[model samples]
Target: MTNARIAALAALGVGALVLAALGAPPLVVAALVAVAGALEVVGQLGPIALRSTLRTPDAVSRAAAAAAALAALVTTGVTAATVCAGAAAVVALGVVWLEGLVGYAWREATRVVERLPGYTAPHSLGARQQVITAGWYLAVVLATLTADGRSGELVLGLAALVVALGTAAAFVLVTRAAIRAKATVTARIAQALRSYDAPVMVYLSGPEGTEYQLGVWLRTLERLSVRLVVVVRETALARVVAGMTSLPVVSAPAMADLEGLQVETFRVALYVNNGAKNGHNVRYRELTHVQLLHGDSDKPSSYNPVTAMFDKIFVAGQAGIDRYAAHGVEIPADKFVVVGRPQVADIAAAAPGAPLRTVLYAPTWTGFNQDNDFGSLDPTGPAIVRALLARGWTVVFRPHPYSLDDARSLAAIEEIHQLLEADAAASGHEHVFGDRASSTMSIVDCFNLSDALVSDVSSVPADYLYSAKPFVITQVDDGPSDAFLDEFPLARASYVARLKEPGSLEAALDALEHDASSSEREAMRSYYLGDFPRDEYADVFGRAVEALVASRCPAPAAPVPGTPGGAR
Candidate 1:
């Protein structure tokens, strides 16, 4: 056996002996060690990585990660000094030997390649790196086995081996299944659906109105030849289809049924974020998922590592590109087309009244490892809201969704209290306020009515930027650190101020009121939205859709919804 593996077994044996001597329960130790080992292995070697062309590391991130790891180890125990020291020495020596072997192998390979033309030689990594990796794996397994070693030898060894092997197999199998299922479902779904001359599908998630608006955008814009087919949550599908006679709204079918469709051909399948998660085998259906985000946030929302499933990304602007890139997210840069803000601007245009001058106070959700500097940054959110109210400036206070106390019916109540308490001693009009509403309602209605917006790194601010409205960004921290640096690149297009000291709220508010002019709004818009030629969004986006759709298997003749025995 390898030295690392042998060391791991030795560590396990030591743990079992220690537990027996201490009169401690072996089962308990085994459970703890198993969990720790699993986590360590997962951290050291990822479960499954989605291959992508876009990959970049953020600076200072590695240092922060190291500090976090050290903190975790310190919190766990200081008594493992001897064991840790021994393990470190072994790991170091193993790594050095591994490096030397790797170097020799590399030299030999180089020689072979130089002597033989058109021959590819093997490349080897350093022994040190290999040992370090192997040692970590062994340590994890040993720790796990030791922790549970009190159980009978046969049971413990068998259980640990089975669990490890089963877990690895499950991960690999599931990934393979998902990939295979994608092609099967896409082909089947394409066959079942009817062919419309102009492909028009309303891809929407969230609530019903958003889907309706998407449908409207496709229908009213005659410049782009399109048909209406609403893709909504299964719950709303029947209602949407029943009301609209000219086209069919395709609700997500049961996964088993999608593999049986005979219909084919679609120009576009506009996919709203989170829509596919609601159903199985939806993405495998071969249409291009044109991802339209629900809101225009500069930060990473839908930007998860799993976003590699998407074939094309419809982003807001260059800010979206930079935010996705800086965070190691893998969206094909070539596949991402800057289509501008689609949903928010349409909402703004539809709002009635004499364009009410309003200021939106939107704070990101605060709870569990979140930055909680709302009071210092805008200790006067309610005061400002009240002041704006007195001045006939309608104010919409949209607190973070998580900020809602369980007892409080709405998040707005607690948010107003947080804002009021900050300046209640002096404002005197703390009790004075208008009727409150949720941020969702405000985003769909009030943001367009507002003349300006006040927010702290909220997506609401970015969505408002689309309207060319004046916006003031609240910086909750004093200076740019690692966390701050990681997020600021996203809002490079917005008007931002890092509130360094206390009592800067009034001045910040004043600056927003005075400075948020059409000129400044236009300048920021020109910088971010200047990339796309306005009229070509559909054509540019449509070509991508066509390629994805045409590549799918042709619909079978008279194919039933499911089963191989059915019509083919």
Candidate 2:
């Protein structure tokens, strides 16, 4: 075990020894450790479900284990000291849960307010989960603290006990059912995957919500027939990939799915994004690993230190190559294969629609972590939209998908929507291209629909480089002291402005006025997205995968049907 785990165990042992020295029964000590262990398992679960934590079949299995453990802890009766420890631990667990979940609740209640899209998952736990953990913890505490030898107190305690027990039972039953249903889907997906032995496999073993990234990868990997398996983990992430990309998606419930499958069965296992389960899947020694990231950008994640874990890191351009080199990560130059933006080619050009000059205002969501806090939705987003509208240009606001994760981003989106709605009413033209579910559009579709783009530092702008269109980049106002992520490399070539005040607006207007960025676009495009002749990325991507396959397990040279010379 790591030092932290060892430390935690040592601390727990010291605590047990103290209780024993205080004349506590051995049973109490045992119960204390057991309850603490249960809480540890649940607490380590943090906000993200513990089972899905592995991103494997074990996620469901762990869910079942957690629920069962909670039930046993509640139903079992021991000495008052034992009950007190359990209750204190429950209360402590609630506090721990709150420790993780408080931010989620705070964000949900307060709403994340940013001039631009800026966010990360609740630093601790979600509001809903906080409430659940609190309720259970309080119930157990009330039951234990109020317990007495008197019949009246006993009766009241028993009633509290009932509520706690009922709650635990409900969680267990619900978790079991959910696990079973998930297993059914996973088994079906596994069975489907078992039939395919495609040499190139595009595997998505991450959460379901991230399937959008896989959709783009699927489009990038189009033309070549390959298996796009969504390995089942905590979220049925493969469902989205299956729906989006009609490719056969297999759910690997266990290692059994990969049983007997060797390098002969599958040559390359390309992961869309590195996930926790990805580390588990990588253990399969025979499969050649190729890391195909969602999009190529200058974000720290664009060239994570972990990318070195894979055999090959398929990059978008020299930018991706230089990004790792600059970070001083150990991935060699040879493993970095440049594959231009293939997904951009699939995004059909948007037709000019009811507008004088249309601009796609697509800002990225506040990042999930502070390392990539490059969203500008709070401070500059509204002003930028208004400025564009004032200039008689229809603004299409396409906020990042995760923009609605908190209140602040949602409010900003709502404000932008209101601006668009008001503009549409007066101008007789649709200002918001993405609002309702039907009207909700993809980044590529928005790229096609707009004349230009004004986005934050993200893949949206990076991919827009493919259109050779003029776009503006918005810088964040306040962030960490030492996060040096060049999210938008084009800022050096194109318009780069800050969201501190109305600077984003000024820069955007300048871009709209000048709009003539063919030279800049071509140069920056070549810089980020290498020179793809005629803009055909499918051939480039295909050739790269073919090379990977050839390197790992090349096709056997066709034996001259009779003899080498005779066939000729």
The lDDT leader among the candidates is 2
Angstrom error of the Cα, residue 503, model 2: value is 4.5
lDDT against the true structure, each candidate: 0.44, 0.58
- lDDT by residue (tens digit), candidate 2, 1-568: 2225534544553454455455454444444444534454444333233221222232222222223223334444565433543443354433333333322222222211111112222233233443444345444434433422234544545554555555555444433443344334323333333455456666666643577667667655656744433344322354345456555544443454444233355778888887777776677767788898887887778878988888888887888898777778768787888888777775554342323388888787777788777788875678778888888887777777777665798888788888888889999887655554214666677777777788777877778877766777776764431242253456765576656644556865686567656677778787787787755665788888877777767557877767865464
User: RMSD, each candidate, Å?
Assistant: 17.8, 12.9
lDDT of 1 by residue, 63-113 (tens): 122222222233233334323422332333233233333332222212211
Superposed Cα deviation of residue 277, candidate 2 (Å): 2.1
Scored against the true structure, residue 389 in model 2 reaches a CA lDDT of 86
Instruction: Name model 1 segments beyond 4 Å from true.
Output: 1-192, 195-224, 232-250, 257-262, 275-279, 282-285, 344-357, 362-393, 396-411, 414-445, 476-486, 490-501, 516-523, 530-568
For candidate 1, which ten residues in a row score worst on lDDT?
51-60
Cα TM-score per model: 0.47, 0.63
